[model samples]
Target: EAKEYAIYIGKMGKVGLMILLVTITSVVCQKSRDWHVGVDTVNPSGTVVHGHANIPLHRGDDGNLNANVHGSRVFGGPYNREQTVGGGLQYEHNSGLHGGLDATNMRGYGTRYSATVGGSRRLGPGTFSIDGGASRLPGSSRTEGNVWATYSVP
Candidate 1:
């Protein structure tokens, strides 16, 4: 009789766990989606703090759009101290098109700027894409650019 009681208790424990999981899943699924924010702090000899956020601009059947912003600060390091802030906008479409523009500035350093554009489409039995970008680094007079094409089939 003790062996039977032990078996019944094990089954009951499993059933209780299953019910808890279902309740948690339902609560999570019913929550609304929104923007995201995050922060990081580390202190190993030196100290560093970073924060970022993602704001949703639009969401539809075609695609989605979002804006991102971030900043970082360093203290008590060999380099003394430094800080940087930047933000960018990104977009996507159902037609296989995407692009983004970004810029950042660092204290005691010049600002850097960059932009990227790319698109992909069906070509015969495969897909073809062309991506290109250009950027000018901080405190640099020369601008760098690159372009490439890719084809893939599966």
Candidate 2:
């Protein structure tokens, strides 16, 4: 019957659309996973083509993970380009303590790596936090840490 045919077609269309969406998303993710993109095209073309994304692929009670990619073309064209791709993972304990590490590599630069460990505790009227870590850049390295306390006034 015509009615039956229409219903079948509708279901097929829905499935096709879903497949297309998922495929596009996966392709985009894969491309960005290895390239970082950036763009600033504010001109007569009215096309500001810039791409930078941070995708959180997993998360659970104990921790979460993310993927980051950044790329940028020349101001008006594609002659000059740059990209950076990396990811980060972090975990938190029930006691309000956490730690994480991040790493990335750029097109022309060497690998950059960093690690951090921090803890936060809630006090009577404020919250206190301490974080310490080190970073290794292309040609140098540095250590950094911070302690912060925050309170709100009524």
Candidate 3:
């Protein structure tokens, strides 16, 4: 019947429209992701060498998530034979928000843990921002925290 054919056509049209919308959304919301690596020698003799790498877990149009690991060693200095290893996760959002959590361990000293969060927003004719962080060292019973704020106009 003509009524049955018209119903089928209407269903097909909706399916096609959904497919087109999905395609457009995929193209517009593409993500950016990459890996980064670096090495640095502080002195000419290369007594201190630091190496680091950053890997992207999720990088999208509105935010980014990354994991980073780093290590440093003193080859031939007063801190010779000393080394440190650290790793952390960093997140940033297009909505003026960011945060990080990290842990580091030194050869002689114990491990240190830290976390930080910050955000910024447009207030009046300028931008207001505030950042706060807390850290704790190994064998310490107390945690230390600090906070800072700023307002800027362009």
Candidate 4:
């Protein structure tokens, strides 16, 4: 029957399109590297380096494809103090799926590792985000979370 044939062709077409999209996304993620650098002053002085990749996986044109890897070195200034090294991965999809893992050294203290999951959506002139995760540090482990909003006025 023509109806059956058409249905079969439609299913195949969808499958083929999905395969193509996945291949293209893999290639783009492999090739794209947008590097960024910054300084953090929360504890003495620290250097932060971040690299990002964009994948075309957004349903809305206003959203972004984000994947980032970052590292930081915190050193005491003008005095000898605890020095630490930290690194993490940050990923956020336009479809509101976000999560990452982070690890850090605490000088004389043991290392800490944590994982976070969160979601964000556009709010009035800003974005609202909430996330929670647990950290394993030295002799103990703890969990925490917070709700935050950011706004950029153009």
**RMSD value for candidate 2:** 12.0
Clashing pairs in 3: none
* Candidate 2 structure quality by residue, lDDT tens digits, 21-109: 34544567764443333224445432222344557666677665555543322222343334455666666665767777887776578
Roughly what TM-score does model 3 have, to 2 decimal places?
0.63
- Which ten residues in a row are the worst by lDDT in model 3? 32-41
* Candidate maximizing TM-score: 3
Instruction: Write candidate 1's Cα lDDT for 1-154 as tens digits.
Output: 2223323444354344334433443454334343232323345543444555566778899987877766655544454357788988888888999888888888888788989899989999999999999999998998999998999997
* Better model by TM-score: candidate 1 vs candidate 3: 3
Decide which is better by lDDT, 2 or 4.
2
In model 4, where do residues sit more than 4 Å from their true spots?
A: 1-81, 145-154
Error of 4 at 64 (Å): 7.7
lDDT of 1: 0.66
Candidate 4: residue 16 Cα off by (Å):
55
Q: Rank the candidates by lDDT, best first.
A: 3, 1, 2, 4
How would you order the candidates by TM-score, starting with the best? 3, 1, 2, 4
Work out the TM-score per prediction: 0.59, 0.50, 0.63, 0.46
- How does candidate 4 score on lDDT? 0.51
Q: Between candidates 1 and 3, which one is better according to lDDT? A: 3
Cα lDDT tens digits, model 4, 1-154, are 2223323444354344334434443554665544433334443542222222333334354444444433333323443234455666666676666777777776677777888887776778766666666667766756554544444443
Q: List the residue pairs that clash in candidate 4.
A: none
In model 4, the Cα lDDT at residue 138 comes to: 66
What is candidate 1's CA lDDT for residue 41?
A: 36
